[model samples]
Target: MNDLGRIEDLPADYVEEMRKVNLVPLWPSLRGVLPPLKPKPQTRATMWAYADIKPLLLKAGELTPIEKAERRVLVLANPGHGLDKMQASPAMYLGMQLLLPGEWAPSHRHTPNAVRMIVEGEGAYTTVDGEKCPMSRGDLILTPTGLWHEHGHDGTDAVVWLDVLDLPLVYYMEASYHINGERQPIKPDRGDRAYAGGGMVPTPIFERSHKAYPMLRYPWDEARSALLRLGQDRQDLDCIQITYVNPETGNDAENILGFYALMLRPGQTLRLPARSPSCVFHVIEGGADVKIDEQSFALTEADTCCSPGYTPVTLHNRHADKPTFVFMADESPLHRKLGVYEVRN
Candidate 1:
């Protein structure tokens, strides 16, 4: 009918005209709206075995040149959730980046926040916005959004590190801006001074033009000492957990992510009930059994595991002699800021 009796039964031509004017019919779509409550996360618990990836990384190094392979990285793709098979998750991007000795990964800057956790080798360095900082195994480096950064290895052995970014989230928002920088010599630019004064409070002059942590490098040595001391000093400790804070502002790593280093004592088990923010973890030292929801993952050094938001997980260090060191990055910053971040027993 050209003219229907009621507004809900409008003519097809009239509906088409409304749609042409950027109007959407809400009656048919509004019924599908529902609350967010759901059983376990849609993003499944996934693990990337280091052993399975090492040889392929080595082979890629032999065949591909750093100049050609802007990033000789193997992205960790989550099979359970992603628009494409190459995405780590629907919201984040995770990759294992390798740099062979004498190789230089060109400088680039992007809108998404970037994090690098050294997993293998040392003497390699990453220069962020002109300040070149040395890398060592277990060190956590932050390259905030839109910061020009590059990596190179000067050591004898190849260096590998975990590359974590909010690429998926930024890309989804259509706000991603990545630009490659010209090849240039690495500059010290007071990066060494910050590293030398590792545990001390950073001076006001050291703060760079970034919203994230001023201390770019959080050395493993200093963090290890602090964790061990915390364990020894306090008997009521549930777990030795420490957040990589922006010393100047005394806040989480940044406004979008929370980075943490936690330790589980030998033969100990820590039960993390569940929370609102998803967490991705990197095994820094020793081995542990991570039970996410009902699935179990055995992770060793350099291995990575993801426990999606609101999924209860338990970490167990069955090793009788060594403690388990785990580095984790999560949406805690966002959740906590929104007053939704929480952890049960």
Candidate 2:
């Protein structure tokens, strides 16, 4: 394409008049907003090591009390978006939240949809809309938009979890805000049990659940078992993966983002196709080397990495003797909703 006229080429008086009237020429910066082929994403390949973040997180716990901090968290900010933005991708926000024993994070509801991927420890439970979902390593708990959720710990150790949210997108739309509330009454129903079986869902014989988010907690044990079974049953499959979805509707668990569990067989190396949605991967078990574009990240257990959109990612299991499992969060749902989702071979 020919070079477009630069803003500097415009007449000084015309430029001055346009500036005075708050009008700006688009031809000079047109390519920036409408890049050819694919988007020029600002999100870069970034990794946050658990080993390096743990010390700082623990220190943050000592520095700030739960009473003052509400939710003691250290954001896993991507440098591409700038540290101040506190976002891992264009639409996703990631943070490591620490909850010490005998502490409680007050109940509140926010417009941004969020899910907690338990990183370590036990005896901590997140009460979402009155259902107390126990926190265990690799467990996923949802605090969807407009749902009241709070955290409490009863065990003797500190519990930590990775918080993934669509805060960046919601905040960008100027619809991000929270409403504080008193402790919610414990509900007798547990969504995990109601939707436990894979091929079965509760039949609405007597009564049906009207809530949008019927299942809030996805136990890691079940997810891990499913992946192992899938890998065992499908030896011909190159990439063993499972999507976390609503058992009833057979759709993504949440509306804004997509959650998935991926397993790499022993000595397996899988290359994901270049897609239009950026992805965040967190190691749940074993180690894997993630290569995104020109950057490679060696991620151990609990380590997390982010890859920009429209980039192919290669995941290699570092362990030859054992299988590796990873939890992935992506902007595919939002992208699809906006009619921009893609997968390039």
Give the number of the best model, judged by TM-score: 2
Which residue runs does candidate 2 get wrong by more than 4 Å? Answer: 204-209
Worst 10 residues of 2 by lDDT: 202-211
Model 1, span 219-253: residue lDDT tens: 88888888898888986998789898877666777
Model 2 TM-score?
0.98
Give a tens-digit lDDT track for model 2, residues 253-276: 999999999999988999999999
Q: For every model shown, what is its TM-score relative to the native structure?
A: 0.86, 0.98
RMSD of 2: 1.1
Clashes of each: 0, 0
lDDT of 1: 0.81
Most lDDT-accurate candidate: 2
